[model samples]
Target: MRRHRRAKIVATVGPASNTPEMLKRLFLAGVDTFRLNFSHGTHEDHAKVHAAIRALEAEMGRPIGILQDLQGPKIRVGTIRDGKITVAAGESIRFVLSGADGDKTAIPLPHPEIFAAVMPGHNLLIDDGRVRVAVTGLGDDYIDAKVVIGGTISNRKGVNLPDTVLELSPLTAKDRVDLAFGLELGVDWVAMSFVQKPADLLEARGLIGDRAGLMSKIEKPAALDRIDDIIRLSDSVMVARGDLGVEIPHEEVPGRQKELVRACRLAVKPVIVATQMLDSMVNAPTPTRAEASDVATAIYDGADAVMLSAESASGAFPVEAVEMMDRIIRSTEQHKLYRSIIDASDPGEEQTAPHAVAAAAADLAEVIHASTIVAYTSSGTTAARIARRRPAVPILAITPHAAVSRRLSLLWGAHSVLSADIHTYEEMVERALGFAKEEGFAKPNDQMVVVAGIPFAKAGTTNNLRVVQVEG
Candidate 1:
């Protein structure tokens, strides 16, 4: 189905939206991509969901994207005495590298990376920053800290070290296993979590190869420090605000999100604004007004996609949440000021052959008020460049590779359809007109801007641009 909006919606599958029936409903409601979060659910369960999504894709005759999200190196507090402990502000807490339960004086941390990495004056945020502590002393086995924000500390509460960079791989044993299974399942994208550096993506890229798009989750301050490099190494980026908010000051999250989205746009990569976009919908049938505005703000910032985490995975209103988000995006895009905002934040032109062609195509289409911009891409690179321009008209990207078509579903303004490889300029023009008409992007006498690589199918070459007109 054609979406009314440009930005894509990625919904995670879980208890609430696990059934094939529910999955179909979500697709109809506006989900362009399905995210299989490895943090929860068994491999078997995810396999079933993957199968269901493929079945739905076949029945619907639309290329759907699947993102395999790997849970990376999550550090949480170990079990506490009596299942919980209360430490007052300014209280001294000594964290030991043990697996046993403990009281306030000697809480078990059980993570050597933290002990090895954290230094004096580093801040440790626990339970999503509900309780905070500043490192005062560190020994080989213990981390002594003064409580800065005190609250009840429970067993396995997640810990966030905002001021320290832990020396650890983004992938763990569980993630490797999940990545293998997901690659075998033919997922379109693999999202790595807890990415702290550009080098962190090298391992994932080596493992993933060209099988799927590698996306780095931007939730760590260290990631922000090297975001351009991370974005350069990865195919896409995700603003994982839930964890990001805890790691950085809450006020900085929005600014960071805007900068990340704009940076990705400038780099011509898809960026997803994720986590709690419609958080209130998990319990309520509708979202809070602020949540709706949040989704719109991401769209205004030019994000390629926005994701639904718990809202769709375990919420009471999964379909409703998708519908609401879809409506929000459409409404925001149609807002009179939306185009102006997108134009104002435009990163300008990249001085290269492919980018020049894409920009010329966008410029020509707008000048003539064309019905659509048809990009004949084999590697999907040309289409992505066009999408980065935020063209006023819809982008009908025709690709010979179904995988490329599916992956393009995440790009803003791209409506990809798999077709046989075009052999000549005559064939290219004919197919562009045919597909544009068939997809309802144009009618007889309508104008279209077409672009492609000259040698074709060789990839990364976007040299040709043409203005084609529909004929009766």
Candidate 2:
């Protein structure tokens, strides 16, 4: 069942949502992407979810994008004595960051990388910002923190010391193992969490190579600090709102979300707005007015996707949340100014050549009232770029790789098809038009626009643009 909505819905799969029935319902509810959060599920469990989604896709005859989210290096304070402790402001509480063996007065920090990088007076937020502390001293194996804005500290609470630039790789050993599994399982996109710099994305790409597309989850404040570089390195980006809302001041989230989405658009890269979009719907069948508006805002901001975390993963109304999100997206998109904003975005020089060309094709297609925009891509960059434009017409992206096809299925306004490799531009155009016809996206004599790169422009070089009409 093809959904009429343009903004994609990403439903995170968990115990409540792993069933085939639930997966099908969510798909029918307009979930364009499924995110497998490695933070919660085991490989065996994820395998089952993966199988269920694939089966559902075949049964429905529609493509569903699968994203494997690697639980990046999560820094947390070690266990507290009695499993809980409370510290008052200006108290002399110390986070004895030696190892995971401290009591309530102090907690061990297991991440040596954090210990080495932390400097005195830096802010340290624990348990998703429940407790705030300032670093006071550092030792070879231990760093001490003074309670600055003390609050209740519980067992195994997440710690976010953003001021400290830890000398650590984004991928942990578990993440590396998960990356291999995700590749073998044929996941469309690998979402690397808490990505701080371009090197983090490059490393992930090195691991996945061309096996799947790399999507950087921009949640960390450090990532926002280096947004341009990270966007340049990543194939796509997700604005993970959970930790972002926790780490940064709540008032800043709205502006930040808009900025990130606009940045992604100007760069012609696909971007998703994620996390707790419909938190109230985790229990209620319908979302609160605020939640509905939140989802609508993301769509209005030109996000390629809006994601449901706990709402679709472990909520009482998993499928209903997806359905509600879909309804809101479709309704808001009716009078939405998405096409105008997308059309107005000037593809900057900062973007890659292929990205710029794809944007140009989308712009021209919108102006010409083309039936469809056909993209022949190897790395799928051109296809993703066109999708980012969010033109009124559908984007048919034909690629030589199944991985690329699966990944592009998640983007806004894009439908991916796997085709045999084309060695030349003529072969590329013929294959694209043929697939478009077979898919019933275009008819004979229908006009369309095509974007590609010049010879030797590399796999993702999409500097060439051509407009043609299909012939009988």
Candidate 3:
């Protein structure tokens, strides 16, 4: 099932959509990629879901990408005596480093890194900002804080220190285990959370090697400070606006999201605008007008993909949410304004031979009114570059490597198909035309613009462009 829309949909798999029937429905509903959230499910649970996805892919003969989202260094308060407590504003509280039960006066915060890194005057947000506290004093084993906006504080509630960049690795022990499991499962992308600098990516790369594409989740304010370096090192970026909104001012999130999206585009790294995109759809049969507009806005901004978290994972209407997202993207792309906006934000100046050739193919497709732009790629980079052009025609990316075919699934306007590697120019054209016809992207006598590298099976050598007339 080919989607005419450029922007793709990423659906999370959870209890609500764990069954094979629901998984197939989501794939048919227009989910280009499946996100396996490591924070929630167990390894066994995720393995089952991964197996289901692969089964569906084999049944349908369509490449599907799997993104493993690592749960990085999530800080939270430890156990409380009564399980919860209600603190009034203007009250004082103590966060003890010792892992012990707490009363109204104090709570255990087992994460020593936070206590060691936090200083007086730094803000600590609890329970997703439901309760706010300002550090009044720091001790060797505890932090004295004054409640600024207090509410019910419960056991294991998340703690966010927006004012301080704790000296910590992005990966937790659980994340390392999860990463190894995901890599073993052969996931296409691994999204690292709370990445503060480019060095974080290097650490992940050292572990991941080339097993999967490393996608940096840009949430921390420190990450935004060194956005360029992070984008350069990472294979992709996800604008995780949930923690981001909590860390930065809510009003600044939209601008920051745009900046990150544009930066990733300039770097030619795929960017996913994620978190709360259709949060209302988690329960409601339909999304709010604002929710729909938020998705459309991301597509208009030339984002490669928009993601659904709870909306698809544990929502009452998973298929409906995916359909709504698909509708929103299609509607936005059909707007005359979208094309102009995408053109205006074009990443000018081709930096490599492959980039120049991809641009030429896009132009050729437009001039000839070709049915599709066929890209023969080994590592999927050539297809990605062509998709970045936001060409009016669909991009049919043929690859020999299953991983490459699956990874290209997330790229905008890319329709990936697995085929044997082509050796000669004639073989390339023959396979391209045959697959385009078989895939219903074109008919006999239709024209296509094909792009690829010269040396067969060579990666990152996409320097050839040709316009071919499909044989009758």
Best candidate, TM-score-wise? 1
Which tens-of-lDDT digit does each residue in 181-250 have in candidate 1? 9999999999999999999999999999999999999999999999989999989999999899999989
Count of clashes, each model: 0, 0, 0
Question: Candidate 3: global Cα-lDDT?
Answer: 0.91
- 10 residues in a row with least lDDT, candidate 2: 342-351
lDDT of each: 0.93, 0.81, 0.91
Could you give candidate 2's per-residue lDDT for residues 1-472 as a string of tens digits?
Answer: 4467778889999988998988888888778889999999789999999999899878866678899999988887776667778887877666665545466555777777787788998888988887888888877776666787778888778888767767778899999999999899999889988887777777788788877778888888888999998987887899998888887899999999989998887776789999889999888989889999999989888788899999988999998898899889988878656556655654454456666677678778888888888887777777777776677888887777766666776677777777776678778678777887888778988888987766622586778888888996
Candidate 1: RMSD over Cα atoms? 0.8
Pick out the ten consecutive residues of candidate 3 with the lowest summed lDDT. 97-106
Model 1 clashing residue pairs (backbone): none
Tens-digit lDDT string for candidate 3 (291-347): 999999899889999999999999999999999999999999999898899988887
- Report model 3's TM-score to 2 decimal places: 0.96
Best by lDDT: 1
lDDT of 1 at 373: 97
Local lDDT at 441 for model 1: 92
RMSD of each: 0.8, 3.0, 1.6
**What is the lDDT for 47 in model 2?**
95
TM-scores for all candidates? Answer: 0.99, 0.89, 0.96
- Distance from true location, Cα of 332 in model 2, Å: 2.3
